[model samples]
Target: MKIYKYKDSVYCDEDLSCEYDNYAGDLYDLYLDLKEDNKCGETTRYYVCDKYTGYDEPEELIEEEFSDLVIGEYESED
Candidate 1:
């Protein structure tokens, strides 16, 4: 799996065959909990890393709050 760090959150990129939806949900939940606990930075940041290539453009990353659908792209295999 590829780990991308954007601001305070880290996104994991996994293969298409892998269960990315479940993982994304889990990560979002974790992010929420962390935010509530003040574990995340004030920026409210997150990332979208590729699991296979472990590659993510700096511009592709997102931070400061995001929609569930927006995050879904990170989980996408394509």
Candidate 2:
């Protein structure tokens, strides 16, 4: 399970271990709560999962679900 921390929020992959539908709601709530406390710009966390595979469980799934999210444009291959 890999967590990509973006400038605004985090992005993870939803798999059998991590269901987006279930977590998304709670995550949104947390986002709102955090926004209320922190006066910074609002950002949203997103889960990228396979539409075919109903497995949306753990945060680890993000590695296989979406690799692109981890790779930054300015990051070197080395």
Candidate 3:
């Protein structure tokens, strides 16, 4: 399946190192959700990568769900 990854600085200043992969959904939908939160401040920023990743969930898996948003190559946590 295809999925997207994104990053956001929510409910805090970008310089605070609070940015993380904290949201999941369509870009616009996520943006609106953040906007409604109001804690992210007016300058909160959202970023969507340019390539989509192929994701496969193990049939017996129970951890991590799927997200649909902008496309991007998956980055290693390392």
Candidate 4:
């Protein structure tokens, strides 16, 4: 399946962290904890990379299911 890959320097940790893969989904507010804590945060810029994996579980996949905003690839991380 397609997923967002972290490609930011530092600010990614501020807003993008904690947002789940399904965070792009809608079930979050329906059942997850911190129901009242729902609010759109600042729109921080982020970089993106496309990666495909067949594994049911990926390595870089967050252990706690977090999100981190990123900056797009201006200069290659390479």
Best lDDT goes to which candidate?
1
After superposition, the stretches of candidate 2 with alpha carbons farther than 4 Å from their true spots are 1-3, 7-50, 71-78
Residue 70 Cα positional deviation in candidate 1, in Å, after optimal superposition: 24
Q: State, as a TM-score between 0 and 1, how close model 1 is to the true structure.
A: 0.25
Q: Which prediction has more favorable TM-score, 2 or 4?
A: 2
Q: Could you say which candidate leads in TM-score?
A: 2
The C-alpha local distance difference test score for the whole of candidate 1 amounts to 0.37
Better of 1 and 2 by lDDT: 1
The list of candidate 4 runs beyond 4 A from truth reads 1-59, 62-68, 74-78
| Each candidate structure's count of clashing pairs | 2, 13, 4, 14
Q: Would you estimate the TM-scores of all the predictions?
A: 0.25, 0.27, 0.22, 0.15
The full ranking of all candidates by TM-score, starting with the best, is 2, 1, 3, 4
TM-score of 4: 0.15
Cα deviation of 19, candidate 2, in Å: 29
Local accuracy of candidate 1 as per-residue lDDT tens digits, 1-78: 233333444455343325433343233444554456554422333433222222132223323223332333443435
lDDT of each: 0.37, 0.35, 0.30, 0.26
TM-score of 3: 0.22
User: Residue 49 of model 1: what lDDT?
Assistant: 29
| Candidate 2 lDDT, 1-78, residue by residue in tens | 343433344443322124233232222333343345542222143333223332243332344444444523222235
lDDT of 3 by residue, 14-39 (tens): 12123345534433343445346541
Residue 31 alpha-carbon offset, candidate 2, angstroms: 12
